[model samples]
Target: MAVHKLLDDLYEHSYSLIAIHSPLKDYRLAYFLNHQLSLKLKRTKDDFSYIENTSFSTFHYNDDTTDTAWHLITNISKNVVNETRDTDLFGIKSTTVLHYLVPEYKKVDYFLKIDNGDFFYQLNAVLKIINEMTHVVTAYTVDPNQLKSKNNLIFLSNA
Candidate 1:
């Protein structure tokens, strides 16, 4: 892809990312982002509207769906800040993030929650493993249920 074309393509479809829908893709976002969100990325007709979500940290991705949502959400937060010059584009207020983890998280700061049902309960082992990997200040998970018209800062925590 030409430099301009690639930048143009990234602009339109940049904000929305194709996350690791399953444990299989978390460690390799390029494959899934390229394969999964291909159509969305095509909407950009040019201009620096979007940049690829490449927030590489010491925290490398691993094939663990346990807290994959949390890691991805944190990545989104850092990505927005780094990519958008740290501007709060949507003018968000309080953000509430909901994620499903089998064992649930402890002493978490920022907006976050673990579902009180089987989704998390079933994946208990995975949740424990993922939780062991992180110890940071982050707002993770956006509840699809709260996605009501614009009041979705909390909902966007997942995005």
Candidate 2:
């Protein structure tokens, strides 16, 4: 599957997932961190330990508990960019969720928006990255009804 090449092209370098919780929960950040790390690093559950294996740190929105917190995943802490949005979903917040394709990942023609953002912005982000890919492809899991194939964004049913 494409995930194999997506993983193979990125086999050597690191990758990160920026997962934001929809319902808003205390553990969403932590849970996604665990899942992303384990999946990206190919680490087994027994080996998942941020303190022991990685320098990546977790940050949460301050004083704005209502604004959903995003999981900023990246091989390099520098790849994660924070911004403020005036959008409907989370506005006037201190932190925003987005990632840049580091040099290592640019060659791979794909992007992923596993579970993130309001429909408009997330798809926009997906397109921005998708346009950068040559033969590579993008895939993400979301409710089928919410997917819009403007440029063929790969859809994954939650099952």
Candidate 3:
């Protein structure tokens, strides 16, 4: 399946915190994200006014300028450690399957830091979906407490 179509499906189901990867694609990881976001923007022309307005954004640490990409990616994982906002959905796309197995960053952080409440169930549902997809491509199950001690300093939390 096309990567964009996969993301579109997730978006439709109200899963804002998502991660996507495609082993079949040979292009840069950013290419798929930019393509999909632009398409969504075009399709949602009447309601969405900005790239962020589409309700999802792509976050990457490795723009290929430095060695901090992994650090940045981990920091993002740390900060969201249980994000509660339903409005914040993001995707991490990469052609390499190894990128998918970077030691439980996003999934673990989000799961561990979330506070118990109404959104917990919903978030669990989304994580399950994400895990299903991740496992298919990377063979690693998303574990909530997988990276409790892991730290990356580049993308430090503002809070």
- The residue-level lDDT of candidate 1 at 15 comes to 21
Task: Kindly list the per-residue Cα lDDT of model 3 for residues 1-159, writing each as its tens digit.
Answer: 655434322321111123343342222323433353221111111221122212221233222332221111211211122334555475433231111223345332211122222334555554444345422242222333333432221112221
The most accurate candidate by lDDT is 2
Inter-residue clash pairs, candidate 2: 109-136
> How accurate locally is residue 112 in candidate 2, as Cα lDDT from 0 to 100?
30
Question: What lDDT does each candidate get?
Answer: 0.28, 0.30, 0.27
TM-score (all chains, Cα) for each model: 0.21, 0.21, 0.24
lDDT of 1: 0.28
Model 3, runs deviating above 4 Å = 1-119, 131-149, 153-159
Per-residue accuracy of model 2 over 5-116 as CA lDDT, tens digit each: 3432222211223222232222343354334333221212231123323232323221133222222222222223446787758654554333322223423222233432
Residue-level lDDT for 5 in candidate 2: 39
Model 3: how far is 73 from its true place, Å?
3.9
Poorly placed runs, candidate 2 (over 4 Å) = 1-48, 51-53, 62-67, 76-121, 125-159
Predicted model with the maximum TM-score: 3
Name the better of 1 and 3 by lDDT: 1
Residue-pair clashes, model 2:
1
